[model samples]
Target: MANYINPMEPEIKYNIALLYFNEGRDEDAIKILKECIKLKDNIIKYHRTLGVVYLTNGKHDEGIKEVRTAFKLNENDILTLNNAGCYYAIYTNDLHRAYYNLKKAADGITSNTDEYTKNVIKKNYNDIKLVINKIEKGKPNDSIKVPDLRLLY
Candidate 1:
């Protein structure tokens, strides 16, 4: 509703993009993502969310590329890693990358010891562990530990 670009605070630009996305306005989200790039080009979240926007719009390749860059920047980002992995695993059906990212997510969650965090991880961990068993069982061919972040978000 207001101007997407703030005069300062580069991170807010990303939030604006997210607000656009949460509002179900993909075009506005794209515009804000581009603006975020202009303000601070190195933020991985902007690209990650941009990828999500593109993916939601059915531009899977563009989404994958952008989200992959985000993954490169932050391997532990549940959003980018899981999204890219799922795109590769389910959509494109690239089992290796899918297993890698999903495992990374599952492992990352397990690595945190806080009870609250563990409980949080426990839920998704259980789901992702299913995928892990698939990968460890000498088969990336299964869809078990798919790393769904819908619950996390």
Candidate 2:
């Protein structure tokens, strides 16, 4: 028989990856997400998902590269902005970029944004701001840790 394929298979794989991620199976999620990306390379969500999996698995560079590619593909995506902000803050320790991206995500929220999502974005924005304030005040003893919110997706 000839090879059979479903056009919706990529989405199925993406959903499966998400399920694995929620179960804390980062490795399995990474595998499925990679397959999904291979089948649908143009989809930003696939890249973003894979990036998040990599980051959570401690593959920092790979995660940043994937997320950066997604950002390049669609800078206006709030998820991309949030992921970039979290990645920069936690992994690269680039506070400026993290703040900028998180602020952009927060500012991008609109009427279409659900209340829960709006709260999450605002909370993250405020948390980053607090960290920035402490840093600026030369509070070297204060260490701020940004939460990895990617899994909440």
- Which candidate number would show the highest TM-score if scored against the true structure? 2
| After superposition, candidate 1 runs with Cα above 4 Å error | 1-8, 110-153
lDDT of 1 by residue, 1-153 (tens): 776654567688677778888999889989888887777777887887788788888888888888877878887876565666567665765666665765666567545455654554445445555655666885545555455543222
Write one digit per residue (lDDT tens) for candidate 2, span 93-150: 8888989998999999999988887887788778888888878886667766665544
- lDDT minimum window of 10 residues, candidate 2: 144-153
Candidate 2 residue pairs that clash: none
Off by over 4 Å in 2: 1-8, 139-153
